[model samples]
Target: MITASRVFLIVMGLGFIVLGLNGLLNPLGHLAPYGLDYQAPGWMGEIRANYGGMHIGIGVLTALGAVHYAWRRNALALQLVFLGGLAVGRTLSVFLDGMPPTFALVFIAIEWVGAGLALWFLRSSN
Candidate 1:
């Protein structure tokens, strides 16, 4: 039987993979909703390499954790770090730069939830 934690990891991993691929393949479209326009030279490549690569790396790690019991804890830890960092960064942006778009707020919530879930599973497994 698949545990809830494993299920969560798998779902999150796949979601990240899709998001990363989309960003990499279509930087303009992917960023359009976020109010970012890649009109300058090399901006698209920068987004594809940095943002997409980060998400892909995280997604692969998360997926590995779901399939490999030995890597599960470490994977959760990585996720906690990533999601928690994002949440913290977003909070700082909100304070320093003022409120962002609604989508950004939604992402902030998701980041917190992801971090919380990772923390919960990590603690429960101990």
Candidate 2:
């Protein structure tokens, strides 16, 4: 008996898991969208830790939420925080650092929309 909320949580969780795997396995390809490059080992470690480890950790958290009914709210909150944070940073970069590539712009839009949806579901569930 999967409700819409559970489905949403699963989707968000899987999305993060995929992103994390990409970051860990193909660090350069993951950063290619942003035209970011790193030549040093320390930077590679940072990328794997931050982008790879963090996203996977977050993904597991949301996936847990999908599994446990009581965790749904927390999962939604995670989504709100994660996606919202990304949207905010990207939006500020647009204003402060100048226009980013279309790839970033698209992500910004998705993040905002995803954050908004998370919030909506959170409120509706309460």
Candidate 3:
């Protein structure tokens, strides 16, 4: 039977995969809510390659952690790093640029929650 932590990791992995695909396939639409509007093709390409690829990589690692005991710790570490970094960046933005949209706030919450889950699991295991 799968534990709650494993289920959380799997769900988080799937979430990242879906978001990554959306960013890769539709950069403009994916970034619209973030107030990012790039007119140049190069900018759009960069967004698709960088943001989308990053998320996809993280998703794959996270999913691997769910199935591979050897990879669980490392996968959780990666998740913590990625989500924590995002949460930090968002917090910085809120301080420097003022509050963002509701959707952005929602993402911040998700990031923090993901980071917290990863941290909790890591600590409990140790």
Question: Per-residue error at 93 for model 2, in Å?
Answer: 0.8
Lowest lDDT block of 10, candidate 3: 49-58
Candidate 2 wrongly placed segments (more than 4 Å): none
For all predicted structures, in order, the TM-scores are 0.94, 0.95, 0.95
Model 3 quality (TM-score): 0.95
lDDT tens readout by residue for model 2, 36-107: 998589989988888899999999999999999888899999999999999999999999999999988899
Best by lDDT: 2
Q: Write the per-residue lDDT of candidate 1 for residues 10-47, one digit (tens) a residue.
A: 98898888889988888889899878898675997888
Off by over 4 Å in 1: none
The residue pairs that clash in candidate 1, if any, are none
Tell me how many clashing residue pairs each candidate has.
0, 0, 0
Candidate 2 structure, TM-score to reference? 0.95
For residue 40, give model 2's deviation from the true position in Å: 0.6
Give the Cα error of residue 43 in candidate 3, in Å. Answer: 0.9
